[model samples]
Target chain A: MTQQPAKKLYIHDVCVRDGFQMESVFVPTDAKVDLINRLSLTGLAKIEVTSFSSPKAIPALADAESVLVNLNRVPTVEYTALIPNARGCERALKCELDEHNVVMSASETHNRANLRMTRDQSLAQFAEIVRLTNGTVAVNASLSTAFGCPFDGQICDDDLLANIDRIAEIGIKRLTLCDTTGMANPAQVRRICELVLTRFPELTVTAHFHNTRGMGLANCIAALEGGITRFDASLAGLGGCPFAPGASGNACTEDMVHMFNAMGYDTGIDVANLIPLANEIPSLVGHDVPGQVMKAGSYDRIYPMPDWLGGKEQTRLAGSGNALIDPECRVTEVAK
Target chain B: MTQQPAKKLYIHDVCVRDGFQMESVFVPTDAKVDLINRLSLTGLAKIEVTSFSSPKAIPALADAESVLVNLNRVPTVEYTALIPNARGCERALKCELDEHNVVMSASETHNRANLRMTRDQSLAQFAEIVRLTNGTVAVNASLSTAFGCPFDGQICDDDLLANIDRIAEIGIKRLTLCDTTGMANPAQVRRICELVLTRFPELTVTAHFHNTRGMGLANCIAALEGGITRFDASLAGLGGCPFAPGASGNACTEDMVHMFNAMGYDTGIDVANLIPLANEIPSLVGHDVPGQVMKAGSYDRIYPMPDWLGGKEQTRLAGSGNALIDPECRVTEVAK
Candidate 1:
């Protein structure tokens, strides 16, 4: 039997920042701190702690500074924060974040709606943010709407490449092509990532996807096949854009970790341990969470067989069962 | 750019039988009729309406005969039912089902527990069912646990092939290799489907997968790449073994239809229409369902921009409009 070559994939968890921001309820600062500390112990390469945004804009993440300051960061886990502008960058720098993420949408309509700026202006702002930080933090410029945009039907590959080239010129070494509205197909994912990797070999391109269209994992696989080794996932599939109608949750961290680990790839995250943290979200927020893995549990957690069945082979089980039963015999009585 | 030739893949919706049977609430016979009727209009080539099991065993699908009799079958739709034994075959024959499905788990433990028989006994029962049905219904035998089994890990390919060969000798025209517990990896799925399709060119091999490990879609893609086209998906990711511990849901019907349609492969299913039906299941079952697309809705649903916000070129003019402000200076907020 031939085995596929093993690959190392970096998992950047965004459950606290991206995941919590989308929820209606504001998670308490202490809870956020606890959640971040819990996630740090799970062997994640990076944990996106919070966003440095105005309190009035995203009230849910208003306690970003307190949350960041309170987090018990693991030595090996890199803690990052989302910085939308120079002001946000300054706020993030105050927290001494190891990395800061600045995003620009590829689609002009989404750019205008999401960031209230054109693509070029967003790029310029990102460049300014990078300069203001003075290399204090590693800046990851995320190209949102790289696949297809919710506002616009389809995004052109050339437009996406042009943006990547511009970001690369701004001295951003790390980049992420985000499917903000989850409109990306695997073919589109492969094409976009391949083009970027081929053009900017030195740069590391990460993929951030939503399960809105149910192709999140497929797109991840396509990106992996196209030479991308970094990805952003929300714990238990948390996070959704309030502005993007019909947008589902982000790719579940547990699900992604499960896929990578099963496929002979190392994600450096313990999927089983992540479940409890994932399940805590719905209670933290006042609504039902979108994640499936937390509710369903991992594949290894088995239900106990009936005790009444005893030593005799259990028969007439609905699906797959363990006990042996005689094929020819008919058992009329139900086990009490 | 060269386009890959579109593969012709088939989808067999098993929601009525496999899906509803696992549910705690008994879906009314009229509702089952309505659900199957809606699915038939959605371009499904095949639909498994019910299973010919004893009413005492599976009370949820006890109305199998009534459900089949009431279905508004469209032309080209192959309505099938699961026949567990010779008695079930007789019941299926009486229902006048277009096709009768005989299932046997490849793992001895699963086979014994699920069917109350050993491997050989199950095969003998399948043979008897096949002989007794005598073309009244097309016989399609499903080999469960073809991948890894929970009880017995890592089922060998030769074991599955031997079963396939035995079923072939009994003149079963169609065979489905089921990942009963969702234990299949892509390479394993490809290898088994490739072997089955190559060795039994006359038999129509279909792949049934569970999303227990999140590799359901990947495994399906691998099977398609390996030349096995037919697949089984449950609407809204329904169906799990109540007896099998840790088993969750089947591969979502809406998710699968969305992928196939996006990939330009025709499964003869309308994802747009099917999505609504998928969404309806949660309410019918009185719980939040596992499938994401149904809850999130499709990617095309448009979100209305705030009236307070100016057009795409509008510059922010209010308190904390800064968050919505684009990084690009293409649009500037004018004092209003």
Candidate 2:
């Protein structure tokens, strides 16, 4: 009978990693470490600290090693790092991170365009990374373009399930189904998530969605309905996809928390503390970010009563000390 | 099992009336009539054209009668007008509007502030208006501040239900529960909507939400889940409350329809045709509006297929026209 089924939803904050990866402006390593360190205290279930990609390729997160080594990890929080390839895993293993999050797009074309490898090649690389960190860390695979691909059109169900089937074969029990490029709708998300979960009941399902088409929160709600309990969100809705500039980026950490919390679903992340972090985003990224609740505030946050309503009109007495003309409110006295 | 429970969900667009009323600059009568005329053809269930309030009081919608008279009403569309008093009803009767939408706030304080009448007085006046236009037009009452009042913190459930009970007693068959300041939350919306519908099974319930706190679409989806069918949305997310300027206004018509359509619910409205109308709003209003899908295209709207993917990589061959992928996918050609 409950509308909100996720009584204690697990929120994964990805601002420092996936979000910063999109920023054209390179946030300093010290700033990244400081922000992640601050975010670690915000009651989030997980935080993806950084990506160990080649500095020549992505200079923004080039200092992944330094950020990871310097992080003041929270005891209750799981700290994961994005390992794009076996080399990235080698680099992250030195940092002694909590886990490794390997990513491969479900679409063969997107895989080739983004990772410079075919789907098969990417899966082999992921398997290599998974093998490298088999017992060293809790490794998980993120199936990007699980809903739709930018380079290609709608990802076929068999093609997507095949990728999930392949990753499951590699003993990767945890999976993050990503709507890369924000092309996911609710019905599509529900169908896909339901399909994945129903097939692999043992897999820990995490939904990573973008607000690309402005359905981030709505999609999140849908995914939750599809029995997804874990979410990946960015601070201040940062990490807007480089492809669709000025559009929705990652599902906003605070906005999602706000929505879930408002819906009576308990996501233990500190939504109030994240607002300050979301506020610092415009300055960090050097432009306005796309997060809504940060600017609009929490549903319970009361806006000041309008001046015109309180001043000349003595009907509602926040301004007036006037006694009620009719206690039952059947009639009202004329304004003095 | 069906994701789309509400097939042919009724969409009631309130752009011309509620939307324009918030504008600082006066939108001309011809423009209002033209927009309504265009909206009439968009397959919406209802359109609230204009409010029949005093022209001097609200200069923005001063020519309500002119706009109403000039409108080329589509046979399939229901045109309604907001009537503040019996005098406004008298004015609307002259134009022969399809329905009369009389509004009264659930919050006594808000009732005084916005309409300059106490809750009881507004109800009494609305009842009088209903009596005047009883058989001439369909009389529906809009209960503003049904969720929360800016001056008043949270409207109690009993008080809101009491107001609903009073209006139903007056023989009004249709009711709109409005989030006047966008203070409605999903759980609260569901609870109240369930209560009202359960108490009065025969009454048609329409939910009017604002995106002030960015919960507009989320709220709409919740209402749909709660078995409420009819909705009030404004074009281009227009009609921001005058009290809280620049924040979300009424739920954008296209955004809601887009979400519904995306979720496989049938709104019976042609969503594609409404985009042009949404696009024209920024120019007409002289300011930017808050609607998202208008800015971010529909979910399936493919973004140029990421040129680099098809160019150097040649993985997804749009330029080469490689004979259609899988034939089942309507494209062919394996990656080199």
Candidate 3:
């Protein structure tokens, strides 16, 4: 067997922010703080609490300030906000944010549609935001649609590299290469992550994948193979790309944690603590979420035999000389 | 960038047999033939049409003989059946069957519960069935719960290897290692596949993964890295462990074909042709299947502009501006 490269992994929970952003009900600001606080205690490396976008643009996150100021921060957990512009950065700076996550779409059409700005204009704004946040809050320049776009097709490596170089040069150390519309495959993720690493060897590459095509975890596996250690995931798989109505949620954090943890890689996040919250997301979000781990239960969680199978179950268990049924088998026959 | 090994992939669609067995609703015998005939035309390498078992045991697939005899057999596709014993072998021998797929769970508990026999008993039965089929039909000895079992925690590699060795010695050329419970991770998959290859170098290894825990595709990816080229998939992700209620179906054939074909590996199955069938499965099975490519459309299928974004969407083409909006974006803009 090939030796698996075990490394320290970082999981950043984006449920309260990125997840709730897609919710139209506008999750109460107190609930957002409660979730973030609970997530912080889960030993996660980071928690993206809320987006510092124009409240007028996204009324769902109009209470970003309220959510952030009330956060019960753990010293080890980094708190971040998806900052859209200088105004968002100014607001984030007031809240003692650890990271200001500025984003621009790699596709021009997506940038204008999503952010109401040109690619060049978005980059310029990010650079200025980086300058403003430097020495105070860390900057995460996220390039949405880094793999492919909804309005445009594939984003060429050259354009992505150029963007990465500009962001890195501006002293922003973190970069989130996002499959904004879940357009990335394993090979594509591996190739793009490799290209990005080769260009900016010092850049921290965080994978932000969507499960739109049911490849969120698969893509994460490929990125891990490509040597990426950080990933942006949503608890309970709560978030979908606001743009793609039919697309699924971000890679479910509990699912990813389960895979990495079961494979003996250390993410340092407690999966046991994340389960209740993950299961609660469907109710909170007013719909079914795309998480599989919760539905399937943890890998080691043995299921009891269904009541319908009791008669057949008895014949098998009592019959097999080598049988050792699960202690909690649901279909155990009563003594005759 | 590290090079991806582009190998020829064998996709065996198990929708008619394994998929239908889980459904309480008995899909009519004609519908079974129709689905199998449609699947045969999809350029799939293999189509496991039905299981040759006691009709009383599984009422759903009692018409295995009629289905096999009536197949509009594709010259390129191999048709197989799940043969449990000499009786099954006798039934399959009557038809022009390509192969007899005999299965035994690696987990003793699961083997006993599912097959009403000990592991050794099942193995002995497979050997006898092999003797019965002789040179006429190929035998694919499938070891279910080879990765992890619902009743048992983990199947030890040594016991598994021994079971595999004995089966191989019995002249079964094709072996399928099944994650019957969908409890496998990528690393675990890679580890086991590597072990299997290292031991029995000449055996044709096939991965039988379920999307139970949502890691089906991820496990497939890892198996590919471990030098496996054959996979057992079901159309529209139809098939679940009858024993495990909440677990999802097998990895969808179209999804796997899409992933492999997109990565430049040759599965030779056309994804476009599989889509309509994938969509048809939910209604056929009387419930929702976990297939995603069907729901979200293909990975590259671009969505059109929503009404409010039209002026900007028009400007996107009508003007040089990059502008778009998420169809569900809550910030549609309040009237001034």
Candidate 4:
């Protein structure tokens, strides 16, 4: 797998938007601004700052405008927000966002249940949102249930491709194929991603995966092997499918970035710097998140020898010629 | 990726031995026997019943002999046990086991820290254990930290191949490459596994992975793509690296099986039957486990619409022409 060099990968964090949207408790605007500012310095290529939805529908993100205005902008990082309709597009345009992400579902049942609109209604509304922007800001259409649906089961290849064509016709250049409710398999992900990338070579395709059934990272790998360069991930795996009962969170950000870097791809994001930020999420959300790297540490983290081994054995191990063994093993002592 | 069909896959469950060893609470011998008997019916190709290590070293499996003697074995399931030394091999031989798995570490620091023996000592002792078996039962060697070590950062490729060569020379036909602390990335796994499979075509290699760094299932995919067919998984994601602080459990059996089945591979194990058993593990171990499938149902599971949607909208949905929407969706009603 390492014999061939891979294309440079871009990691886009959706924690502040997708992740926080699922939280029942309201997060203070100052904390949201602080988190986004800290994330901006972590080398991420893009960050989804907030969602411009009706405050009554999503009370958790009612302070989206406040968060976008307060955060210190990083010139190198692209900032985007989720726009649900033409009203949302107007709000996002006022903020001078780098990108406006419009959302809809590939399946009719999901489109109705999630957005309370028919598939055609969603397409027309999305088209209006695109025209409202008028090329002032880039538009990225996120097609939910692209793999499979909780309301509607397996999505056919023809319908999925047709939906993409309609979204492209609305003048959108970027698309995110979302596995809403985490119903995707690796084989299916690889097949569909390859098909989309082949059919639309000019479009930028991003994969959005959920870890509800624990196939999130596996699907990410398949998408990567199928030539996907952009990904949507959540810090600390904080987002969940409110429609799917007992579902977990989205694909984790630090964990995904760590894998990409380990697999010899330059993601332009440092996982080590994302760890401390991820560790503080449980306190911010008032719950334990599903991130494993935050708890397990990085793969290269060297743990100290047990106390029973004593300093004599430790000293002997320190002098070993094997380069794999770190002589300074005692730098970070963890209780066994 | 699925253009060519894959070889038959074999799943081996090690929950009774490896999963319980790390638990602070000791599960009763009857429960262990019952769980193994139930697992036998799940169509698993092999089951690691228990370890014959010193009782002092693993109080959790102190009743190894009694549990192995009492469980009702299925004719199709091959039973195996972990043998730590010559004494353990003798005990396993007395039980008339189908296979005896002798373990050691590929890295010197991990070998000493985990087993209190040098690499030469472990190799010599493993050779003696193979000799003691005398062809009465199959011998499989598990090389820990084959991918990388928690104490030692990375195991060199040359050393890893050399260790495998030594194990093969000891007359062991089956070997498991263990990611002891989950230090492996997908690229490394695919590259090394391809090399091993090509060099040792006669050997049956099983991939044993830990979910410590959240790459367990992803690593499994890489290994599968590299031609590995056998896997060692733990129920409810039990078992962890004692040396790696805050490490999670092994790659979850139900989760991996779910992914494999979804990807169109026949592992001969029905994931639905394994889930109810996995759901009962937290009570058995007295804590929450890391398995995701047990909490989130299988991908095909169809949940009922929310009560607020009412019967009228649901009735319309029930009549939809799409095959994805199950008309019997109300059979399993879940509160959203």
RMSD of each: 8.2, 6.5, 7.9, 5.3
| Candidate 2's TM-score | 0.89
lDDT of 3 by residue, B180-295 (tens): 87888888888789989999998998999998877989999989888898999988888886545655689888888877876778788878889899888878878888777777
Q: Is candidate 3 or candidate 4 better by lDDT?
A: 4
TM for every model, in the order presented, reads: 0.87, 0.89, 0.89, 0.93
Poorest stretch of ten by lDDT in candidate 4 chain A = A327-336
Instruction: Give lDDT per model, in order.
Output: 0.76, 0.80, 0.81, 0.85
**Better by lDDT, candidate 3 or 1:** 3
Clashing pairs for model 2 are: B324-B331, B324-B332, B325-B331, B325-B332
All candidates in order of DockQ, best leading: 4, 2, 3, 1
Candidate 4 chain B has its poorest 10 consecutive residues by lDDT at B327-336
Q: Which lDDT value does model 3 have at A69?
A: 78
| TM match of model 4 to true structure | 0.93
> For each model in turn, which proportion of the native inter-chain contacts is also found?
0.20, 0.32, 0.41, 0.57
Please, what are the lDDT tens digits per residue for candidate 4 over residues A163-193?
A: 9999998889999999988988888888889
Candidates by lDDT, descending order: 4, 3, 2, 1
Tens digit per residue, CA lDDT, model 2, B211-294: 776678778877877788899999988887655544568898998898787666778876778989998998888987777677
The window of 10 residues in a row where model 1 chain A has the poorest summed lDDT is: A327-336
On lDDT, the stronger of 2 and 3 is: 3
TM-score of 1: 0.87
Q: Which stretches in model 2 have alpha-carbon errors above 4 Å? A: A1-6, A242-245, A303-336, B1-6, B242-246, B303-336
Candidate 4 residue spans exceeding 4 A from truth? A1-6, A243-247, A307-336, B1-6, B307-336
